[model samples]
Target: MTADRGVSTVVGYVLNLGIALLLVTGLLITTSGFVADQRHRAVEEGLGVVASHLAGDLATIDRLASTSDAEHVAVRADVPEQVAGRAYTIHVSPDGNTTKIQLVETRTGVTVTRSVHTSLTVSESTRGGGSLRFVYDDDGSIEVADD
Candidate 1:
């Protein structure tokens, strides 16, 4: 009966280990999804803020370019190079009479768009995120490009 008792103890130990392992695996899987979702939200919010700031900057440039007598107008915009550890691109596109600034995350494909309240027309362009230049082009349109 001693051998039987030993066999029962071993079986119980193995079963306990299996249950603990399963519980840990389950917890990891659940938390991993939550983390990913949180990360995506962060990226989206970050991009939105960036887009708004860029739009505001574009508007400011438009006003300055319209009022000033300077032949060449260039404004430097200081923006982050990366959002949530991901690189992104900035796109300036004209939608009919309205101008839109779109920011797109390279890896995750997250995108945010904001309208620029500018009197001057905006030329369509795409540039990587970083310090950008808003130039009053000779063609009488605002352009966003790499610095």
Candidate 2:
């Protein structure tokens, strides 16, 4: 009877250890995947927020230029050095008679472009820094410069 009792106690402890190991492994797997998913989601969401903000700003500038009597309108924006822990670039192009804002993630090879309708032609340039400046001329032209 004593021997059986000892054997049962040892078996119970072994079973508990195995369960604990499985639980820990499960937790680790879940957390790793959650971290990965959250990382990409955060980047995509941030890019989207930035895109919308820029689009609105550009559109507002266009409206102001057309409707208001202001000579020039200047706007500043906060630029991020990395998107999802990867370097990115912002491009403003004027070839199509519309200003296109592009955010490209170098590591992931992801590019997001937002096109804003504008009557004025823009000077094409690559912009980078802590902040950006958008100057709208009296004639409705746009000049993009970084600071």
Candidate 3:
């Protein structure tokens, strides 16, 4: 009887250990998922900032178009003053009909382009997580939908 009791005790302990391990594993997985989500959010926010800057520049180009007579206008935006540790390039091409703005992130391999008469398109490819492409249409609004 004592031996049976001892065996049962051991079995109980083993079962408890297994339960603990399973809980730990679940917690680890949950934590990992949370961290990944945070990183993705950060990257997305960075992209948002880049998009905003390009949109503002585009708006400026539209305004300039109304007043300026230049048929082909090109502006090289100064690297954004904020978002240190990241590098970006803004290219603007103004033609007789429409203006094209391209924003490229040197570090992330993300390209966002917008045309005066069309929607904004963004494409990103990276190791942490590969490409994301979306379009934002013009309607006095910010729209981000999968493409």
Candidate 4:
């Protein structure tokens, strides 16, 4: 009777330890996936805000170039060098009636596009993100380039 009593207690302890380890492993795996999803969401929102700001800046420069008598207009855009811990690219392209300002992150390939309403013609160009200069030339053309 005494031997049988000790056997059941030892078996119970071993079973409990195994169950606890399994539960902890499962929790770690699930939380890792959740963390990755949250990181991706943050990256998307950050890119979107940057794209919108650039588009607004482009529109402002266009208005000034079209209405003012300035021969060469260069407006410095205050933009971040990196988005979500990664460098990005800025692309300006014509999309039908509106011009599209698209930002693409370097490693992640996350892209966000914003449209600007401008009468002045925007040249299709791709430039690295960071300090930027929007130039309105004497010939009535607007271009974006690295500052």
Candidate 5:
């Protein structure tokens, strides 16, 4: 009878250890997921700030394009101080009817685009994965398409 009790006690201890290990693993996974989510949110906020600054710059470019007669003009853009690590490109068509700006955040892999329609006084901005497309309509509104 005593032998049977000892074997049962050993089995119970082993089962308890297994359960504890599983619980610990689950907690680790949950914590990892939470950390990942926080990081993603931070990246998104940073990208949003970059996008907003680009939009403001594009608006300035649009105003210049409307008033100036200079063809094929290139202006060095000033980005937000917080996003100094990212690279930005601003393109102004020769006609000055359309302007497109692209911001790429290397560390977070986030890309944002903003475009302005000078004739219509409309601006469109979008953020996400993949390539960005900017289309101008005759009515003066800008269209942003993301692929």
Candidate 6:
């Protein structure tokens, strides 16, 4: 009876150990997936913030061109290279009266586009580095220039 009791005790402990490990593994897998999902969401959110910011800035520039007394308005653009740990490229689509700014992630295909209503159309690149410049002409036209 004593021998059987010891063997059953050992077996019970082994079973408990196996169950604990299995539970831990399952929990780790679930947590990992959630973390990954949150990371993607964070990246997209960052892109949205950048897009909104640039759109607002461009709108202000357009207004400055229309309202300012200066014949030619020149301003420097302060832009970041990476948003949320990812590098990106910008695509500007200018129509007769509207400017569409598209920020596309280099590695991922995540893209955010913003359309700004303006009297002038402008173009610029937001890739990586340098002191970017923009010039608004007397005729209320805007153009991106190398600074």
lDDT of each: 0.88, 0.75, 0.50, 0.87, 0.55, 0.76
The full ranking of all candidates by TM-score, starting with the best, is: 1, 4, 6, 2, 5, 3
Q: lDDT at 54 for candidate 2?
A: 71
**C-alpha TM-scores of all predictions:** 0.93, 0.68, 0.45, 0.85, 0.49, 0.74
lDDT of 3 by residue, 32-85 (tens): 999866655565466556656555654554454445655533333333433334
Q: Per-residue lDDT tens digits of candidate 2, residues 1-147? A: 999999999999999999999999999999999997787777777676676677677777667677778898877776676666666677878757578888766654666788988866677878652477778876658777775
**Model 6, CA-based lDDT:** 0.76
Q: Worst ten-residue run, lDDT, model 1? A: 137-146
Tens digits of per-residue lDDT for model 5, 33-115: 99877766665676666566655645654565556654433334444434433443333332355555555656656566555
Measured by TM-score, the strongest candidate is 1
Question: In model 5, which runs have C-alpha deviations exceeding 4 angstroms?
Answer: 61-96, 105-109, 118-147
- As a TM-score, model 6 comes out at 0.74
| Clash tally for model 2 | 0
Worst 10 residues of 3 by lDDT: 125-134
lDDT of candidate 4 over 1-147, digit per residue (tens): 999999999999999999999999999999999987886788889989988888888988988999999998888888998877778888899766689999888576688988988898888999888899889999878888888
Candidate 3 clashing pairs, residues 3+ apart or interchain: none
